[model samples]
Target: MRREITGFSNPTVKLLKSLRDKKHRKREGLFLAEGLRLLTDARACGRLPQMLVMATARDPHPLLDALEADVLASGGEVIVTSADILSKITGKDNPQGVAGVFAEFDTSLDRLDRSSAKIWLVAQALRDPGNLGTMLRTGDAVGAGGLILIDDCADPFSVEAVRASMGAVFTQGLAQAGWDDFLTWLRAGEGQLVAASLREAVPYRGAPYAAPCFVMVGNESRGLPEDYELACDLRVTMPMKGRADSLNAAVAAAVLAYEVLASLEG
Candidate 1:
């Protein structure tokens, strides 16, 4: 049975609206997952939100039956709300019929299971949400074990990032750590740290990509700091004949990640 929320004063609605901000999300340990597709992905990953808010103005989506039933079975709340209310929560006009407020998953380098992980991706100071999200999607496509986000990166849980991820956000293992901490963690591990750099003499194809690989990608502008690049086990460069000095951060990451995947298979 679904609870009908007809007014703006509902506590659930307020909480969902507040989650649009990063600080609020971090404080509450919650984030919003909009659309049926993302909810479907969450359900597939066994990470479905405890609270669901559906637009009552639209016809029922047959796809939502199983999810709604599960939520109700778990003693979770399903809100039957107006289009205006859904739009207010999602900050979009005539938003999708389904939206959910899910608790964020905790991830850390220390918590990562290295035993089964073949390769991981580290993005240092990557500020673009679209790039980060796209990279995550790419990482998922190539079967990366996980992703490490360095200091001051875009909030991966942000609406733009989550939307851009197209459901990869739910499937991928993600963690955040500062530069020093990440470096320490990288060095402590047995995996080969392959840093993507513009200064490296070795071409990307020639890099020593071994099992348990960790591919490090830099920021949109500055890239990996020189000392950081020098600290890596292997440094590789992608060659470009055109005037462009470097590739997009996400594109560079994808290229390197795929190569690492190929190396393991080879």
Candidate 2:
């Protein structure tokens, strides 16, 4: 039987709304995934959402039917609620008509296979969720080992991030670590760190990318910190004969990721 929730004031609905806050999400060890595609991707990635919520009026969204059936088979609960309640729960003007709460996967760099040509895209102080999500999607596309988010990076599970990733967030492994933690991992793997910079004389194409490595992209506005200049094993720049100063952080990451992939395949 599908449970019906009428009011946003209901305790269950209230708890769902709390998930919008980072602290609450952390405390509960879960995050919200909105829309049909994200929910589908989550399941495909072996992430079973604990609860599925859908607006009662929007029942037959074709993509959602399979998801609902799959959730039911997986011993998950499906709730039907009004649009008003969904909006309040999601804090979105137009709720995607579907949303779900999924258990957060504990992703650690230690889980990765070090014997492979492990590649990670580390975002340092990247404040924009969209940029972070784009990087995640690109990372997954290029078969990156995982993403390592450094200090002060945006929450990869946020609504903006999920939307920007277009469902790649759930498919990719992610590790959020501070500078020291990343440094520790780098040392453990003996992986080379290549920092992207506009001032570099060495083009990324010429770098020794065949080895196990992690590429670092800095903040959207300010580039990498002064200390990162010394930390990186190699500093690389993209060739641009045109007038553009630099590529966007996400674009730069995609270029570097594909370059690494090409090197591995060749």
RMSD of 1: 1.7
**Residue range with the least summed lDDT across 10 consecutive positions in model 2:** 109-118
Q: Runs in model 1 with CA error above 4 Å?
A: none
lDDT, model 1, position 31: 85
Q: Per-residue alpha-carbon lDDT of model 1 for 1-266, expressed as tens digits?
A: 57999999898789899999999999999888889988999899888778988988767666788889888888888999989999999998859888887888886778776556778888989999899889888878988877889888999998778877888889888989998998788677678888777665588885678878888888898988898788888888887899987889889889998888887887
State in Å the error of residue 68, model 1. 0.8
User: Model 2, range 59-152, lDDT digits (tens) per residue?
Assistant: 5876688788888898888999999899888889988899998887776666666555467788999999999889988877887866788889
TM-score of each: 0.93, 0.89
Candidate with the greatest TM-score versus the true structure = 1
Error of 1 at 22 (Å): 0.6
lDDT, each prediction: 0.85, 0.82
lDDT, model 1, position 90:
92
Alpha carbon lDDT of residue 141, candidate 1?
91
Show the lowest summed lDDT stretch of 10 residues, model 1: 198-207
